[model samples]
Target: MTASASQGASSISSSSIKRDASEMNNMVTMTTRLDANATVRGRRRPPLSRRQRGNLSTLLSRRSPFSNETGSLAIGEFEPSAAPSVDGVARSSLRDARILVVGAGGLGCEILKDLAMCDGIFVDIVVMDLDTIDVTNLNRQFLFRSKDVGDSKAAVAAKFINQRCPWMNVVPYHGKIQDKDASFYRQFKVVISGLDNVEARSITSENPIPTLLLPNRWLNGMINNLVEFDDDGDPLPETIIPLIDGGTEGFSGQSRLILPRITSCFECSLDAFAPSAAVPLCTIAETPRIPEHCIAYAYVLQWPREFPDRKLDADSSGDMKWVYERALERAEKFGIGGVTYMLTLGVVKNIIPAVASTNAIVSAVCVNEAMKALSFCSQSLNTYMMYMGSEGIYSHTFVYEQKQNCPVCTTTTHHMSVSSIMTLNSLLQQLCDGEFRLKAPSVTSSMKTLYMRKPVALEKVTRVNLDKPLKDLMTSGEELVVTDPVFPDTSLRLVVKFTDVDE
Candidate 1:
């Protein structure tokens, strides 16, 4: 049957009253008599039976779940009599689930609102954010206002949900989650990422907790769902993976739900750019460097030198240089514009609110997918990408089959061996500590070793070993170069290149 037809049929079935024509007529008569009489006289009111009282209560107390003043029980507190049959898996899935949101930004605000208002799912939300409301955030973040500036986002968001649905217990954590330990994070059944940095993403992904990483890209967005299994236990395999498609690239957005394990995990969708792929620092504007001119201009124009008390002694001159350098570094790191010498260069445009709104919508799609996963109604199993432009919306869904020799998943039994998993974990820890190094060789023979300080960006290219043969060096795929030198004593820096590898 068509979905709309089936929905209409269900509605009709649910709304069908069990009362017969005589019972309905009696109810109407009673209602008319009650409306006409200022006080009941002639006959005494009939005592209502338990069943009759229940029917009357059901009719009179039926309130919309989204209503603010509704006396309906809060989520997670449904009465046993109202619970669905235990035999139905779909109804059982959402009975009691704890959802932890790690940010109170634009995306977090929208997801919280939707989860609170939308029916069919029972969710207990815990909001965590270290930031307070800023005037700049008022443009796209919906839950905050000018008056809310400097107020805790988590607290404000929680109050917003409580006012809408008092039954919901929206807990707010007004502290940074970066320093939170794994034990502290275990309270959540699922973790949703609404953060804006690679460090936070990596930390959340590595967490043993089931985590959903929703990062917005230039045009398309990515959702990474990481599921960790118990050491000796196996649960039911994921059945329906919905292919998620849609995101605002230029103007509009599109989304599809994909089932993983049954279809493809975010990593299997693309041979190279998996959902866990690290975004380049340039993409997120984390490693912005100030222009030399800006540094020089700041020093020459803004440096205080006229006041006798503020005279530039040797120490003061060094401090001024340090301040100028620090300011330049910050400007570059945050991708902000450098200090301009000319004030009349025209006003710099702010990041568009529409763009931020688009991001929020895209993030909402990820949250929706999580809700579907929790509610046990996922359908599609493929990678879905959406192209939202000023002109129109375009979407594409592709099923990614596991490569027979996939180093990460395929050749090794679909499950990582304990030792291998431990090794990978160690490597990740090293990467996190900034002790590990990633190198990519350049096309030119002179620029062989590119020392990557951080995994997110290609920073400096230094020639460490000039005498080594370029072709004989061991390499992985064209995009990745692995160096395991045979001679331990020899200080030979190996060369690797970043080349695209076919799946």
Candidate 2:
């Protein structure tokens, strides 16, 4: 826990824990909701009004895969009781533990309701989502009513849950996750990511979470060895919580428990995800073969030419229709079949097949993991868990290893000895496309900008450093940030120990 005088830094530092106003806003909102919903318990259990019923039909009209021709939100007929007391002693955390659920979509809605039904930890359940209620979200997103279309999903879900279980307080934040910084994230003991964005699960942060769990002495030891901080630098410690991640694609879904810094972070195996396939311009333009090729041609080439000033949003029905029509036209010329408005929408939006059953199945596990982390009711998921309902009801749990040389978590800094005559350009060449492949590398030390690759202004200023001898330009034991757009996701942290070999 002690800060090293050499650099005013501790063993674990979280530069990523930057403050955000939304965190304060969410806290304040949760307080207000808890006070307001303490008594509104399910006093009314009426069926959906006429207007809500109409919206349900519209939701079904969208060529969605929901087999149900119609839908309705069923109000619970009985009052929800409090959670059973543990060991015959009432545990009030059921009504006091604050849980933040990010995303009010399919899995999000389920997580919110399942947690509410569990009932003891009902004090402050905050929900955040940037989208409004959509007809397409109706089949799986159980908390929304047809009448709630066009309303903020977070707000609607909170209101619905509060009305159903008056003692439950579901606070809603109708905003983007990026708007909140690390300070806001620290307030909650656990965070669940309900997003379908696979990339969100694995990106590395400058301030990782594992250090939060590191004992003070171990952190001190790790930092002393991994980072070379200057005598004058002082860095503050960061707060990190357990992160539960869930993803669903059609009938398949997976959930994982991530303990930042301590376990395999999302960035450790980012290479596991296959890079998206890009259609060659020739195949898309010259001789389109498959239906997907025709769609790509219209989407990639035709859209830009026809609507130069407009951005294509798959959410907009009009926009989706336009692309489908254009793609369909191209397909006709190429004698293609099996193109429809629904398929076009799916292609453009990258919509995965998700079912209500899968959302419920996956969310239950995520909630169980949350309860374990929050209440210590049972051992939390060792690491990762997946569910596949389509083939058969099957679930698998496993622990994944962090990448050995992960740009994010690895403390292995590169050590190299070079001659005094070695120039910055020479150092760059030495790295070459070998074990540590780097090209057009930009290097910087603690006190000075050693070199910058582009943006003429930066390049001009730092270009002088490139010709200077590496030994003369850098102070002994100073670390440098070697970066390139090639990796784009992680920067190389280097501590260059120079040797003057020009004897």
Candidate 3:
């Protein structure tokens, strides 16, 4: 067969080969025309053009997504565009939807990239993270590079999305969630979490936006969205929306998702992480704690501050020096080590990345599930966990099997009549008061306040230590009394006297 005939046959058989052949024909035609006069003049052959060189490079460098050189699939290789068809309806639901992600860390960046690049469904994304990039996040967090260390993760991620897919909107929030209240939450049709902690997650989950939550509940609960006038003329929705619940637990991280009435509230989900007898000492040592000199801690412990602000110089050399100095000062003031030892040990281990990544993954899962719920497409109320380790990706789902005699979930107490503001104030007052106690098995008493919320009590409360007054054991009120609690050996106790009732 003629060369042209053979080329035509091969091109017709393969679409990619046909495209290449057409381009090659144009190149050959141009070269022949240019060399026509040169050949007549007996001139030397011309050098290869830059365009031809690039074509050669593309042909030679073509690689499969499964290539060992690339640990991950090349962009767009793994994403499925169309959902599985069932009864002529598409199962993949996110089509031309706007999704707002609260953090651009490990999970946010990955989800944004994947959804934006997927072929079948079009997605618009907005990413918000108050954190600037750090060098320590280079491991499992894939969106960043070495040069992006000082840049804002949110902004950098937005720029990346813009460059890769200008069609998608990847907005960034360089500030905290508290900076963006209801107005911010209402802007997006769906909100996704890439947050780091329970506090942030609670804000996104609990925000009462009609667009997200109302529609979500209406759809998921299979209720008609109609308003009804009651006997007293109070208008109410015809149906109450159910909550969505999800959770994830892994060796590196744990996450819980509560969607209004579907699962538990954010507070209710705390039961999964509630202090149990199975919790170990090392795990307890890792929880974030307030410094002993914290005014709140002093108030709770009823002691006066004897040390300056427990700030550390970034240039300090010893791993434990910053902690040791803080601990020693706290020990002197409170007559106990307080959380200084845990803080010091955490510094030594530098588990910030692990915690941060764990948080990031949990946030991502929570956000994705939230979007699913808001889009009226959620499936289950189980907790989803993502385990990233040498053993590979392992996910587990859990459901709250309501106990017949459970104290927290099954109680018959009346719904509190307080407004949202009053409820929050009451919780805060209770926390500050000596009566409604707060404690975390993982954190010292000084850190207990961090975990105080109406939702936390729904989970079993493991009493780490009983409140003991230093005045009871001291011989004289004039002398400073310090002693360690047998329970939380990491903390110290102190008592101070005030003659005036206000003091």
Candidate 4:
């Protein structure tokens, strides 16, 4: 293929590849794990010693994921064995590479392991986590043990990896990722996030995390805002950091390769996450339909009334138990079943049990993409991959396009022509019911806040502005900063250009 054609081919996202359960029956499989009494290659394999078991090089020497005897790399046949003429040089580069992992939970542990075990591809790893290991984390977060509970997750995870791979250096940061500045993040070659929260993942975009995959030509307009210039005035490719983000929920998971301003960012895809379902307060209080309604009632009404001074900490075991008990009482009263602790936690915290298998699959894909990004051993995912293991092993890879008016990545302003007589309510409706489809947007201008949707006191204060005309709020052509729950960290800029309308 020609240069342009090759670029196009590499960039195009592939259709969904389904590996049905029935298909596994037809394929021949080899069992790599030796039975305690089993022989391998016509010889009895001795039991591994503690030191030997911990040593990763002993296992990696037998087989590496990127290279096969046929000189083919799995998944698209991008041959790593062929790509690097001098294996020593490539391996050296990989050994010296530094990668930052932004979680030490289920997905984080798996990501760190996968990246570290990649046969000299990554030796310097930095893992960060604000949480301490809870007993609940032991089931899926394989790196932590029951004894390790109440200890810093990042420290324990690092110690575990370092003990196994003596040659590798794993640095642990036992603090919030927000505490670290750009200088701290810029040291790493790649930033791989195994974080569960969207806000933290979005914050990674603001940090030194890089974006790769998209060509500079297509993203010229957007990159100009983010890309740094070299001494010669050319855009510095080194300044563009690549972020490999992966998340798992239950039996489903996804991994994305992002290039911040140069490609589809985490903020650009915020619309994909459906907004939280709003239940009417009356239904929650007077009549309850499902078990979740009871939980909500207990959380929303009972908690605050009982403990006026204290705020509910969802992570607190005491708080969760109290809520669970109250919710259970409410459920029993309303003749509702299935109001268990797990369900209560889900309803209150809005989190599901992290599946170990799903985390492994997604983390492996994410680390693979990171390796490909650094080594160029294969084409990186262009630029999202979704894995569904609920039924069968199914995957869908697609290129997520960037939003033109993306509040985070782009400064593209929106223009709205409205009559001076238009009420603030009409403008709010236009934002919600119109093309923007914004939910509970708060409108503000350079002068004052025309309306606020949150903070009961402020909402009450600004409530009268709803029926006020645009003329009373501000002059025509005034710039308005429209904030919504959709874009949590940033606001949309809408220029209200006046237009004549006869009443």
Candidate 5:
């Protein structure tokens, strides 16, 4: 061999030696752990009986076997007859409980597995996801496999879980969460979401209108929309269900429990979620600094101009390739680097990188909260938990306060004072640009429709109202029911007070 070839062979040999040494160390650690586990197993207490395990009080009273105390049970006995029952009808167990899980992704898969395996109870579950499985999903979405690509994520995940736990019934809904109405949501005692998208979590039919005035996106609009209120401004008991939400990005994640009207809902803590970063058009079109800038340029400027009649579907391989090529060309021209197909897809689709470990941690917390909410075995996370593994393993559980003037939870009517001379278009603009940050909202008075953005015919009729003054539409102190596409089933009651001044 040549001198350089011999040197390369020596380097490979060194690397192989190091790899072998590392493997040996790992084996030693594993063997040590196994030996310790065997010793502990020898002294392990017998498994608790089904009756004792299902009893919340009994489970709580059981002390740890590893404790220095003499006995494992507080009373040193099992009372089968004392097991809790549901009003003398049936046993108080989660086996009969129905749960709805939305988004059969990474966190969803872990949640389903954990819930099915939890306490050996096979709780009936409903899993929903509109997305189809992709090869990319197999890495973290453990329920799917290479062969399962191109199948519905919800269906595949449900099938896997059902096969693994035959007693557990997992029904899959292969459609958008928005497709389901309030009646469908009322069937579940708890709703757990492992969705990555904010809009999907909120189940918004359309994107919130973009505005610089609001820095945060809409909160769990799904709960607000699903919940119904009585005449006294109290939530209908049947409509209120605990929502356990989990989200993960990189090494960080959070799990939050929302109780409609009672505790803070998703929208109550809107400021916590940072809005998607918006790159200035000037930067994208003129001075490209990063790969994202190039991607945006291709998506925002080039895509429409090139394909005027065809919409750019982010999920379409053809469309994504076209955009990627264009972005590559732009990056090359501007001497920019790091423009990959994945990066382009992420930029166009607005996807965050999901970590499996983070998903698992957050989903476990979510399912635990759900159990607590339903079984009353322990106090529910009061009502938020945050996890950060980027620095070190860190977790915090705390209460998220409810907003008094929240547009969704409370019946507090927002007072909007406008000049009589202000045109309907100006009022609409204010609603879009003001603190409310509503997009494409339809306005209705007590008897007539002032303006509507849908039902093509109705929108055409109300188009003329845009130029009409507020005074011409309604009187002072007239209440207007404002509904936005972002919040389909919920309406914001805005009491419009017309004043003579330009204020």
Candidate 6:
């Protein structure tokens, strides 16, 4: 060291020592100490040197298990046995996987990118989304550009990923998810969704397909940590393919690993969501109180009155202005403030606040969970994880109980009794009237097609059955399989019992 530098270091060290004396005095040391009078010796004198020890042990016999000679065993030495190697879930399995992505929008686009970036892993991905590209989606839907505005989002995203990643096999299904049957989804090993629609996700999760479908993605992340064989040689094979679901809203996000029938699924927490407030028809029509009431009045009442045949398009600026004007006038009558165009748009579209950073964070967690599920690299998420990043980052994870009567988890048939004299049309109409809210339902009994909505020939043949008594077509105690366009994923197995209703 230079003379000046050494002197400067010593001065700094002395100053630091002076400042640290008080702090050091207050601290209690945990280290063990020797006696205060312990003396220091330069070096310990060995009782016997190597030459003396060798001479002393010369008379003793060789002690080693192999032989007495130090070099390469004296004569006939036995070699040690080789240790058995441990095997684990291979990345090759992931490379050969068939993955399906539902929704090619914000979260969907990110999922595709994350899955594609899996180094040295090649897999097939099917992208399914019915929606077309919009100018507004450019914010977080990174796959689309300005020129691709009106193109099918699924096609555009699939094309973008294929072009960017030349080796990726991304197939685009430019149609509504409803178009694909449960059988189609069953072809894939994993189905990851980037959808926000509760109904759509529900359908995907519960559809009795063999393919595991994720209803959400994750909000937290870490490096993949997979264990090979444990103390036991051959680990039991995993039977359940987990559904990794995650979502983000503004600064808050979450990801859950759902083992369908085994773990608490999305349906288990369905009851946690507060039911939508019901606006009484009389209040919305006669005594509108707030902006929402006025808006509902314009949507549910005035639209049909103004244009009987035309449908009010929520995406159209002109249609929205009409609703806003009517709502604004109604609000003024009720002395209600805070009714604006943006508010109208939000109310009509049911737009939720979304943040790009939150989506990225949650998407990473979801994708990572997927990797673990595919290769058993690390433990999958216990059940639920939540992330809140607004006021600094915070997260928590917990296990939620699975629902006993979850339709997705259980094979219990849902039974409903209808009047024996009721016509097939009335029976189908009854589904729409009660708690179900089912529309245009089809029915089958013992693999017999009783009614279906498609194909003009089938519709014509079934039209007569709609007019006939339901009891006449099938026995009262028969088991019927019911499927519909509304709840595409839920194929309800209903046991029909005929009875008379007072109404």
Q: What CA RMSD would you report for each candidate?
A: 17.9, 23.9, 19.8, 16.4, 9.2, 14.8
Ordered from best to worst TM-score, the candidate numbers read 5, 4, 2, 6, 1, 3
Candidate achieving higher TM-score, 1 or 6: 6
Residue 465 error, candidate 3, Å: 27
Give candidate 4 misplaced runs (Cα > 4 Å).
Answer: 1-87, 197-226, 229-235, 303-322, 418-473, 480-493, 499-503
Candidate 2: residue 430 lDDT (0-100): 73
lDDT by candidate, in order shown: 0.44, 0.64, 0.42, 0.72, 0.75, 0.65
Worst 10-residue lDDT window for candidate 3 reads 200-209
Backbone clash total, candidate 4: 5
Which model scores highest in lDDT?
Answer: 5
Score residue 86 of candidate 2 by CA lDDT.
Answer: 31
Worst 10-residue stretch by lDDT in candidate 4? 200-209
**Which candidate, 2 or 6, would have the higher TM-score against the true structure?**
2
Model 2 residue runs over 4 Å out of place are: 1-90, 145-150, 197-240, 307-316, 414-443, 450-479, 482-492, 495-503
Tens digits of per-residue lDDT for model 1, 101-181? 767877678767766754434447888887788666777788888789889999998988888787577889998554454
Give the per-residue lDDT of model 4 (tens digit) for 247-327: 788888899988766677775776676433346777788999888888888878898999999999876889999999999
Residue range 1-503, candidate 5, lDDT tens digits? 99999999999999999999999999999997876675444774455688776644454334333222232111112222243443221223556678999889888999999888765443589999888987567789999988898899999999998898886789999987767777777788888888763421111113222332121123256666667789987778667788888888889898987877788876667556554444556667899888888888887789889999988887688999999999999999999999999988776765568888898889889888776666544455767788999979899988789988878667689998889989989998898656665768889999799999889999999999989998899988889999885564778899998778443
- Candidate 6 displacement at residue 442 in angstroms: 4.0
Error of model 4, residue 395, in angstroms: 0.8
Q: What is the alpha-carbon RMSD of candidate 3 to the true structure?
A: 19.8
